[model samples]
Target chain A: MSRTANGRGGHGRTGGTARRGTGAPEAGETAAELGEFGVIDRLTGERFQPEQTLLGPGDDAAVVAAPDGRVVATVDTLVQGVHFRLDWSAPEQVGRKAVAANLADIGAMGAVPTALLLSLACPGDTSTEVLDGLAAGVWDAAADAGIGVVGGDTVSADTLVVSITALGDLEGRAAVTRSGARPGDVVAVCGQLGWSAAGMAVLRRGFRSPVAMVAAHRTPRPPWRAGPVAARAGATSMIDTSDGLLADLGHVAAASRVHVDLSSRLVPVADKLRDVASALGGDALGWALTGGEDHALVATFPSEDVVPADWVVCGEVRAGTGVTVDADRWGGSGDPGYLHWR
Target chain B: MSRTANGRGGHGRTGGTARRGTGAPEAGETAAELGEFGVIDRLTGERFQPEQTLLGPGDDAAVVAAPDGRVVATVDTLVQGVHFRLDWSAPEQVGRKAVAANLADIGAMGAVPTALLLSLACPGDTSTEVLDGLAAGVWDAAADAGIGVVGGDTVSADTLVVSITALGDLEGRAAVTRSGARPGDVVAVCGQLGWSAAGMAVLRRGFRSPVAMVAAHRTPRPPWRAGPVAARAGATSMIDTSDGLLADLGHVAAASRVHVDLSSRLVPVADKLRDVASALGGDALGWALTGGEDHALVATFPSEDVVPADWVVCGEVRAGTGVTVDADRWGGSGDPGYLHWR
Candidate 1:
């Protein structure tokens, strides 16, 4: 049963790769009720194939061709309680967040997403409705990014854990690494900064009025095309706003061996950030600076003038260490980013 | 930090892939002590780069080259206390089993392994020694299969979960699938059968002196080379013995629209099986036919004579439905193979 192969008989729970797709159509069936094979057949029955997917699911392994012969790959794991609460986000939203997080990482490398491998650690009692929602969410996200779900694995675990490995194509351009920033570089960002984080705070406070913030927290919409665009436009160093702007930029400053000075005033706040912060008596600017999971791309360019119109210049790289905001070292409270363990 | 790309700063706990290489020289540091980034640096500091790895870890996404313009991928997840118990196997053995299970699936596709992406979900209390052992085992297994670890993700979870995605190269050959077997084909197997299952039973019974079977249950070495070799030999159909000889063959027969009849006397049994069975008062033959996780490759050939010398013929494919033994349908008892969540 470990092989969990394709269209095999005799192995009751064997046969199929429906962790996301390669989506067979089955309705209202729990994974346990349908069995692994039946669920796989239902989940992999219909999948939107992208051009880069030389081979899709329903085999021992799916084949994907990279014309550049270089495939960019990274992975992320999300837990049930730590990453999201089932009460706060629907199954589709959870899956979308998972995909968004990984895709943003690919974007950080300035690579165009091509394929994905999704592993779902589900409990036996999980309803097929949840599975369908998750599969649909993954497919939709990949579709949005112009990629395909190639292969995956599914197993029963104590809690739901979504693990995804994303592959991307560099398109014959040099990848923007985190260690490439130098002095005199202008740090800029495209996409929302703290909407998701603010949304998270709003959700935690049980406020439903600002639906947009809550929606952003549940399903982040990353600027997918911005990756290759920034690369082509000559981004010296790049990263995704996964752990909050300052925390992420801290990584850039550390890796590039330079200091970054950010004007908090220049950091554009999310639409609902001020409202949510005011209602919760929280700092919207703090969320904008340190909130993560927005999947916004932050890059360093030699000159701010070269940055596209869509991106906003917020900081500058200098010959120093650490990250400073408004010409002073901002000693924020709490962990810079979310740490798994205490 | 979302990019979580190569060794970067400010993201206090962000950075890099650490499957087995980038062997960092840190001693006596637990995951709790080292945190995620420190562990990443120590783990991904030095990795053995295979020819296919155009860009190894220490970046947002790794780059693996597929010269054949196609890449084959599959994944598997091993859960602690479910797939294995920490007390029954060492950390290294668990990691090795994880790689072996995934590689065996890739081998079933008749492809050569090129790169791997490994994800680890463990508690904060896990020691660096355990991490080292797991990393070393993954590297050793990948090295044994002539591949490299390109990228992966690490996170904290309630329990230990190892998720591995394996990539392979077909090298200009047709992938031998289970649906190609003809009615007149012969069924053959290369490698051990009941050893691992019997080993599990022995371990559960606390018969420690019979070390080999216990070891087999802990670490299964699948015949990786046999996959491409079988593809070259023109096998009609193929599958790995991950779900027992009869159960796995039943899949092949079902997929190929044929009936497979096995001669129990013809199936190979390990040398120590009789004594182990006698001592444990268990049926060794039954174990030989139904035991799973041995990772032996079972395939259908055009004829018995055409089968490789190392493989033993045990059955024949016939124009019928279902699987039979000695000209009668074999209705074996209990689980066909291991299934999670009863």
Candidate 2:
């Protein structure tokens, strides 16, 4: 049964009366008083549906059709303090980031996201407004990716944690995996790099910056369409710039069995970050290479084909098994790439 | 990128190795010293995969094929102390419970589980042995369900939280939903009911029970094949008895728009729970009606057909929109099914 805000008489809102006849607590009452299952029923009371969903909440598992014969799925979790500080990001930002992180993964596979299932754990003291904002954020991100929130679960816990599973459709296209790159392919990028990392540095250092990097850290606006576009354009390999650009590129290199060389001169580092880098006494090149969470699209394409408008050629794949800088190993004097996980 | 304990040249017998291939820790290295991404890489390396997995960990998302065309998916989260008590259940049991919960959802969908994606959040102090045990539990459960651990994410958090996403394949059968039950259909149940609840009561009230009930609470053995069998038998609707029997049956009643009448005598309330019920001055019927987490399959079949050997006829569907006990309305005589979102 689909739910709508303006639905039938059963459990519909009574005019100006905060209570419904479902034996639940009044509107302002605490969730503990109403209990977990009761709140779940109210939250899911009336919701719209998309044709892809064969089943939605109230069943053991939801059935969604994968008509294209292949499904691309990814999961990510964002914990309160470790991933996002409540003081720095609103509940909406947290929700958006949680969805964005996983959506980026689906994009890496060159698939169009279809649906999202979110599970949230939060303290009882959390305001309902916060929950509504989080839901709005999830919906906004899903809308950006042309997907719908098919189902979710909410539970009370000591800290707030958001885990999202994103499912995608390949649209009959072969998935562009990281291992497809070969020597002589042109390496290009379609989105900003290191912006989120710079923003995180600013946040950690408690310094205000004139750059939009601060906003980038709060919500990453990944180029969603670039994935399918690259797949259609014969891109050889692809991955999202999640961990620092160099770290993620290293993954592509290892998987593809090819060395990738980046030309620093071709990278477009944010000008606003120059001042922040100076203020923090950090190298912009290091931030560009080692900073993570940018959600940028890094892809390899055949050298003969003209690069797309949104993309900038940054490097080329070479015959090796690791990443290099300007055709040299990263340890050379001028390179600032490669930060070990430790 | 498959890794095995004896195959990889990193780490000693103890699991506390750094990502940089450094020598094993001197007995007590903290996870903080090893770093976040490093621990993730190590844990991913330790995880094993089954054949159904086309691509396992190391990719943004592991790929698994659903040759059957349809996919059944479910997600569930376990919070420390609420869903499980760390003192009562070992980390392995926690892992098993998490997998069991999601796997049971797949079973309720009348599909065969193929793969699982696990997301774990834990405090930094958690030892590598504890994590390994947890992984072993996940692997064990996946093995039991004939599925593989295809992908997962791990992060640091203040409390332990596990979220599992299970994917299943339906072999060309129409998905049996809760809304499909018609009037005059017979209600039948497969597997044990109220066992987990009974065990929980024993643990909560400091009473003892048979090892089977305690094991049931720790790791539920869901009737995995019963769902697909019911589907093949042309059952109209089905659901897993996660929440109390009546509460879950009420879902079928409300969804199907039919009254469901259950004969209390048909419920399999374990004999071990009878003495504990008397000790707590509680009615076993209350536990049978309101107890949750049994993970049993309850479905409606055409009354003219014979029920399966694994299932017992419990009641029948009537032409109304409510649930009853022995022909009396639900919530009568202080016998209400568990409430939702409480």
Q: Which candidate is the best by lDDT?
A: 1
Mind giving the per-residue lDDT tens digits that candidate 2 earns over A64-105? Answer: 777766666678888887788878887778778888888777
Give the per-residue lDDT of model 1 (tens digit) for A1-342: 344424334221122333443234455457777676655554444466776776566555666776766677778888887787888888888888899988988888888888887787878888877777777788778878888777776777888888887877788887788778999999999998788877877777777658888888899988867988899889999988878889888888887889999998898876567877888887888888888888889999999778977899999999988899998987654236676554
Worst 10 contiguous positions by lDDT, candidate 1 chain A = A7-16
How displaced is residue A341 in candidate 1, in Å?
0.8
Looking at candidate 2 chain B, the ten consecutive residues that score lowest on lDDT are B1-10
- Candidate 1 docking classification: medium
Against the unseen true structure, what C-alpha lDDT does each candidate score?
A: 0.76, 0.70
TM, chain A, every candidate: 0.92, 0.85
For model 2 chain A, the run of ten residues with the poorest summed lDDT: A1-10
Error of 1 at B130 (Å): 2.9
**How many clashes does each candidate structure show, in the order listed?**
22, 12
Off by over 4 Å in 2: A1-26, A29-34, A38-45, A204-211, A275-282, A304-306, A328-342, B1-38, B41-43, B46-48, B205-209, B272-282, B304-306, B329-342
What's the distance in Å from true for residue A141, model 1? 1.7
